[model samples]
Target: MTRPTLQGHLDGWSQGDDLRRDVASAVLALAAAGIRISELLAAGPLAGALATVRGHHADGDSQKELDVIADDLVREALAAAPVALLGSEEADEAVTLAPAGTLAVAVDPLDGSSNIDSNMSVGTIFSILPFVGADSLLQPGSAQLAAGFLLYGPQTALVLTVGAGTQVFTLDRATGAFLLSEARAFVVPETAEYAINGSNLRHWDGAIRSYVDDCQAGTEGPRGKDFNTRWVASMVADVYRILVRGGVYLYPGDARGGYAQGRLRLVYEANPIAFLMEQAQGAATDGSRPILDLIPTHLHQRVPLVFGSRAEVERIARYHGGASAMPERSPLFGRRGLLRA
Candidate 1:
C-alpha cells in the first residue's frame, strides 16, 4: 500500500476547526525543522563542530551549539504559527508569541544533546495545549490537544498523536516530506526486555529496586521469565525502541541529590511521551500513578517517568504499590527498622 504523506493524512480530517488547522500547520513546521536538522546532522564535520558546548541552558544542562541552532530554527518556524505561547527547556519561562492564538506549545527543542558527541540518537519533543489561560500551560497531559516527537535517528521520523490515535511519519530525504510509515502503531502488551539505568540501583527507591531485582533474577525469580535489559540514556531513543517492539523504560526518583522529583521534564517529556504511549495502546506512569494525570506545578517540573507495554508498566506499578504495603518509615531506623519491627 502507498503510505499517505503526513499532510495528506492531516488533510483527510474534517477541516472546520481552527485548532485542528493550526495543529496541522504546526506539525508541518516541525517536519520542516526536523528535515533541516537531519540534513545538517548528515554533514559529519559541521555537525561535530555544532556539538561543542557553547554554555548552559536555563535548566543548568550543558548548552551545545546544535541545541541553540535547533531551538532557534524551531522558534522561527513557529513564529507565525497559531500558537499563543512557547514553552521550552532552553527558556527560563514560557513566552507569549501570539496573544490571540489558541494553542500553546511546550517543547524540548533538542533532547539528549549530550548524545551528539557519541553519534547517538537525539530528538525533539512537543506537546500542544489549548490557550484558554496562562494556567492552561500548567494543565495535565489529559489537557493536551496533540503531542509528538521528531526523532533524528538513522532515519528522521515523527511519532504523533492527535487524540484519535498515534501515527509515525518517516521523512523521505529525497522528497523532503514526511510520509505516514505506521498508522495506528500498536505496541505489544508484554516483552522480556526492559530499559533502566541499573548503575543507580543503590539510590533507587524500594519499588524501582525491587522491580529491577525481579527482572535481574530472570526465570529463577517470581516472574518465572528471563529478561534482557538495555539503556540508551536518551529518552527518545529508548521510547522509540519501546514503540517499535515492547519493553519498559524507567527514569524514576532516587536518593541522589536534586533527583527526588526525578530527572525528566513533565511538560515537554513525560506528557507528550505519555500521550503517544496511551494512543498506541501502551502505558506510562510515575511509579504508582499515571503520567497523564500529573498536574504540572511548574513549566520544567521534573518527574519520574516509566513507560512502555501496558502489562510491564502495570507490573512495575504493582511493585510500587507493594512498597506502600511495607511497614512505614521510622525516624530511628528508617525503612529497615520498620521492616524489622
Candidate 2:
C-alpha cells in the first residue's frame, strides 16, 4: 500500500521532458481539484441518493454541478505553470492559456451531464496537446500530447499518458495526491466483446446490424470466439473499462435519424479517447476511418464510433467490408429465413 511518490515525480522531470512533467503536474493538480469539487458536491447540496439526483442541463440558466466543478478544475489546471491554451466542454469558445504557454488542454469539464443529475459516476476528461496560444485549441487530434479521464465514483482515480504508457492512479483521500494503483498498458483482444446501444436496434443500418448480430452469435456466428456486449451511457465509464479490460465499444452510424452519426462529441470525447487508445495499443474509428484522422468541421462534432480491442475492432471494420450490400441475414441465421429465402 505504498503510494507513488508525487514529490519525486514532480521534482525529477527536467526541462527536456515537457510531456511527462506536464502530464504528472496535470494529474497532481487535477486530482487535487477533483477532490475539492467532490467534497463540495457530497456535502453541499446533493441530497438523496446519487442515482436519483439530477443536475441542471446546459439549457438551464444555472450551469449544472459538473459544469461548476469542471470550470473550477480547469482553473486549477491552468494555475499550474505549463498550461497555455485552455478549451472546455462547458464553454463554447476556447480560452487563451497565457501570453506564451506550453500546453494545449481540451477538457470536458463534466462529461455525462445527464448522469450528473442522477449521481451516477460522472467525471472530467482532458486531452493535452503540445501547442501554445489559440492555435493549440484549434489544432486537430493528431496534435494531442496526452489524454486521460478522472472518474468520480466510489474512489476517485486518474488514468493518463504523456505518450509513453497509460498509467492509472488513485486519489488518496488523506493526501489529495494521486498514487499509481494500476501500471497500465492495454492491448485489446483481436476479437472483441463489444458495447453498443441496443434500444436503437430497430434503426441500425445494415452495417451496424450485421456487426451486432455477429457479436450476439457467439461461437455460432462467423467469429469463432463467443462474444459479450455491454452498453453504458457514460463514455468515460465505457472507455475506462476498455482501457483495463480488453473489449470494443461501438456508436456507429445507424438508421435512426438523430443518432445517425452516433452520440459522443468529437473534440472532447472521441478525440481524447482515440488519442489515449492508440497510446495503449488500442484503436478508435468512426466506422470509415481512424477517429483521430477525422477533421472537425464544428466544435460539437458527432461521429460514428467503434473502438477497443484491435482484433474485435478490425472484425467490425471487416463486417462493413466496403460491400454495397450488408449481410442482412447470415447464412447461420437460417433458422428464420431458410424456409422463406
Candidate 3:
C-alpha cells in the first residue's frame, strides 16, 4: 500500500480544526524548501551559484548563499498562503501578509548553516501560532498551534507536532512528496547515550559539569552506567538521532559573552523542538524550567535548550536545581573510583 502524503494526513487530521488552510500552506512551504535544499546540496557548495549572500542575518549569524535563497522561497510561499505575519531569523521585523489570516509563522530558513561547508546535516524550523495582531507572534511556545522541522540530512525528513502526537515524514524522491514514515513517534525514556559539546566543558556551570563528570565516570560512578557521547553540532541531526533512539542533548547557558542568555532562538528552534519533544513523550527545558513556558520578549530571543528521554532530562534538571547542594567534596570528586559509590 502507498503511504499518505503530508497533505493527506493534514487534511484528515485537521478537517474541522481552525487554521487548517494555514497549516497546510506552512507544510507546503517547508516541503518546497526541503526539495530545493536537496538540489543545492547535490550541486556542491563550491558552486558559484550557491555562494554566500552578502552580510549577516538579523541575529548576527553569517548568511550563506543558500540561506538567502531558501528564505525568499519560504517567504513568498507563506506570503501567498494564510500566514499573516512572517518572522524569520533573516528579517529584523515581522512582515505582515494575508492581513485577514488567522495564523502567524516564524521560521529559521536554514538552521545549522555553519555545518553546511562540512557536508553536515542542516534543516529548516517553523512555528505556527494564532494571529492576534503582531503581538501574538511574540507569545510563548505554548501558544503554538503547530510546530515542525525539516531535516536535510542523508534522508530528508519532516518531523512535526500539531498539539497531538509527533509524526515523521520522509521525502520520496520518486513522488516528490513527504510521505508518512513514523506515526506517533516516541523517545526512549532512558538510555545510555548523551549529546553535548564536550570541548566546552570548562565553561559549563556546576550542574552541567557535575552531570558530564558522572557520564564520563562510566559504570564505576554513582549512576553506575556507561554513556556514549554524540555531538553532531547541527541541532537537527543531533535531535533526530535522539528521536530515533534515546538520548539527551544539552546546549546550556554558559558564562561566555553573548551566550549568557543561551544560544538557540526560542521562537524558531527551541519552541518547535520542545513542542515535538513533549508530543513524543519526551521533555524539553532550559535546565531550570520548561521550554514551552518561556515567553519571548522579542522575535529573536534565544534560550538554552535541553531535551530528550524523560528520565534523562529529569536528571539534568536535578543537577541544575541541586547545583548548590553539590558536595564541596565527594568520594567521586577529583578522582575516578573503581568501585561504584
Q: Could you say which candidate leads in lDDT?
A: 1
Q: Which model is ahead, 1 or 3, in terms of lDDT?
A: 1
Candidate with the larger TM-score of 1 and 2: 1
> What lDDT does the true structure give each of the candidates?
0.85, 0.69, 0.84
Residue 213's lDDT in candidate 1? 66
Question: What's the CA RMSD for each of the models?
Answer: 4.2, 4.3, 2.4
Displacement of residue 193 (Cα, Å) in model 3 is 1.1
Model 1 CA lDDT for position 196: 89
Q: What TM-score does structure 1 among the candidates reach?
A: 0.93
Query: Considering every candidate listed, which one attains the maximal TM-score?
Result: 3
User: Distance (Å) between predicted and true CA of 318, model 1?
Assistant: 1.3
Candidate 3: which pairs clash?
52-65
| lDDT per residue as tens, model 3, 142-205 | 9998998889888989998888899999999898989999988999998889999988888888
Which stretches of model 1 miss by more than 4 angstroms?
322-341
Per-residue lDDT over 1-341 for candidate 2, one digit per residue giving the tens place of the 0 to 100 score? 67665445445543467566766566566666767656655553454232333344343423565576568766765677577667776776676656566777777876765666545676788887776545665567887777788887777777776666777777777776677777657866664467888888888876777677656666655554577777778777888888878788888776665667876778878888888888889998888588888877756667888888876676667667666435546465542211110
Best-to-worst order by lDDT is 1, 3, 2
lDDT of 1 at 103: 88
Q: Write the per-residue lDDT of candidate 1 for residues 44-105, one digit (tens) a residue.
A: 46656978889986656788888888888888887778888999888888998888888899
Q: Mark the 10 consecutive residues where model 2 has the least summed lDDT.
A: 332-341
